[model samples]
Target chain A: MAGVRILVGTAKGGFILRGDERREHFTVEGPLFGGWEVFHLAASPVDPERLYASQAGGWFGQIVQRSDDGGRSWNPVDNAFVYDGEVGDHLFYDGTPQPWTFQKVWHLAPSLTDADVVYAGVEDAALFRSDDAGASWGELTGLRQHPSGTQWQPGAGGLCLHTIVQDPTDPGRLTVAISAAGVFVTEDGGASFDPANRGLQSGEIPSEQAEVGHCVHKLAQHPSRPQTLFMQKHWDVMRSDDGGGQWTEISGDLPTDFGFAIDVHAHEPETVYVVPILSDSEHYPPDGALRVYRSRTGGGEWEPLTRGLPQEHCYVNVLRDAMAVDTMDECGVYVGTTGGTVFASRDGGDNWEAVVDHLPRILSVEVQTLP
Target chain B: MIRVTLPAHLRTLARTGREVVVEAAGDPPTIRTVLDALEGAYPVLRGTIRDHTTRQRRAFVRFYACGEDLSQLPPDTPLPDEVVTGREPFAVVGAMAGG
Candidate 1:
């Protein structure tokens, strides 16, 4: 009775899709918190039943929702995300110094080992950890207080710490990516951090290889090969061999390298997937065709998997956190688009089918494999 | 008990009806005291109407009593006699915004 649960965060609410191991059929569950923008939804690897969601909107602000029964039921947890000490300032859009402010949580990373522990990546660029499930939170200020923090600028999406990758082998080591600020790595847990964007060149910035000004869109890492990382930058697809210490372009033959979502195959460490959009200005697929490019030999070699996808008149964009892979034997890959379609590829990326269509614009997609 | 009318969204969040009654601490219940009591009764509504740290009313949130806009008034300003006597319910409204 093994199953897979796909937790989808959308602009309006959250939905959970349940499918058996075959991955052919799925039952859709909710609009959990209607009228609220659900930024991200994640379940603890340690306890599949425990889940956390980042529910936020302009009118109601931010509220963390927790589900102990695996999205069957949920309750509101602590929403207070106060900074640790004096909130410093970062460069505003106009290059003027602006004070850091708490906006909303962008991503949630549950502990790899502890069900009660979770980390929240939030806008205004800061990290917060909650040890008592989602009942409380405390900022891990070292990332924001880095020496190069003053030079950090907001991307089009605002200054947000959107992606967080935790090393399964080393709990103390964590890597986080910020928009318009590049990447940061922490070795001593959250006590300290260092910029890890060496070889990441952004032509948009004054210095192409600057230490911490690149706008990284998303990052993906395989559990077995933690040292090797795949990234979808604002304009390029990249790979890092030494745990993000150095990176090299792998955008190779992509029609366009500007995309938001990137993910690695569940069983193949070298296999990665990315949806190439036209460009930064035109946030849609090339030639009105939606294709998910898969690279079996890591970055350089890739092929389009478009069996069941839209080949014409498609103009939807895939967000940074809208792609995920489930740990099934066949390796199921899922992608949610801004046009409200959730596509699933049961046999790697060769074939695809829409699990559910016409949902609100999807914000994030996460999968859980149940035993 | 001071009667307060909440916006649709806030009422749904607090799991209450359109109107709720709370006991404000001071003899003359001001906006601050009434909100403190409301938050104390329903902790989930803490940061919805105002900020968690600064306690400032959210930009789009407004307050009114006896058809007078009280959003610009100081937090400590006394409520009108109708509101204080429970004859009129102090209103917490979400201003018209977004398409």
Candidate 2:
């Protein structure tokens, strides 16, 4: 059958497991948009029946759901983002000087070839574009009017713009990852942007090579080598080859590189993936073991994918868009946990299974490979 | 008509059945003309109960009626005559602070 949907995004709703293509049986369906929070779930490489969700809540805000007969039905569209004129300011993790605020849609990048073109990564960090498929949305504003955006600061998950990386062979390049603001590059398609965070360092700021407060915690590339990027920084495990403009500290032997997702293996452009997490206030998994550190040769030789997961008590924690990969043909690796389990490995991670476990608390994991 | 109730997640995204009668004809009947007439007869409940360019109101939403708390009144105020007729329904609630 060669089908596979996966798409999950949780913390109350949105799930659709479905499976085939030897990834072995699965058929979960959904919490649909129930209770709200769906953070990100995109599918439209040129229209796989078109789908895009970022439904949110805290009492109904940020809604954008489009599915033209794919998720079986959905419409919502247009949740007004407004910001083009006076919405500029950032730096308040006590650095004071606040202002720009709109708080929700944490990620949803659609348009690798336009299913009506999309892209919205909000939460005060800014960047929105909806070429009319999700009804309407504007504001690209040279990425918060770049110029190092008043030294952007606010991570602890507030200043968001969470990972957008799309360079399917440069349709005017793109790479966005902001959380404490770091790594921004839009070679003239997103109107304007710079700070690719040259060789990021950030020893808690005050110029450790500052350009835009480094807190980038995820940025994988590989649509056939989009200039080779791959990061999982909030604490090293980076590598760039001139796309995010110079970075290199592949975090070699990795046991504690502190992480929040980083991926890049669809057919091995040197293969890569990360799930380190043990430091940065210990967010679980180094000794509580749930390993998944592959790297065929992309970032410093790694290897841990631990059989069907869980080694001794398995503490969980695997977020930052919650990892995903599936172009099928024997390469399938999907992960989503904060203890709501989703792990599946068709063959890439070497072996693992569990497509749907608890359900609410995943946040994101996309994949649509139907045929 | 104007009865409105929704909020079990917008009655499951307007698939309906948490009470809804709608038809907020304005002239003095406010709460943004009854949510612009319940999102103009459920146009996907427009930005989910207010906000699609600062029409404001969604901070864990709240809007009651004959029981007042009209979500802090003033979306042009004036609502009560049994929620402006249809004998008080106008709900929309869902607040319970963070986590």
Instruction: Give me the candidate number with maximum TM-score.
Output: 1
Return the top candidate by DockQ.
Answer: 1
lDDT of 1 by residue, A1-371 (tens): 48899999999999999998788779999998988999999999999999999999898799999999999989999999998888889999999999998899999999998889999999999999999998999999899999899999999999999999999999989999999899999998888999999999999989987999999999999999989999999999999989999999999998899999999999999999999999999999999999999999899888999999999999999999999999988899999999999999989999999999999999999999899
Query: Per-residue error at A367 for model 2, in Å?
Result: 12
User: How far off is each candidate at the interface, as Cα RMSD in Å?
Assistant: 0.7, 5.8
Q: Kindly list the per-residue Cα lDDT of model 1 for residues B36-85, writing each as its tens digit.
A: 99999999998999999899999989999999999999999988999988
Residue by residue across A1-371, what tens digits does model 2's lDDT show? 46888888888878888897776898898888877889888888887878888888868777788998778888788888888887767779988888887878889888897678788889888889888887988988898988778668878878988988888877667889889888888888889988888888979887898778888888888888788888898898989888988898887998988889878778988889899999888788888988889989988889888998888987779888988998888789898987888998988898997877988889789888888
Write out fnat for all predictions, comma-separated: 0.57, 0.79
Give residue A273's error in model 2 in angstroms: 3.3
- Give residue A53's error in model 2 in angstroms: 11
Clash totals for all models, in order?
0, 1
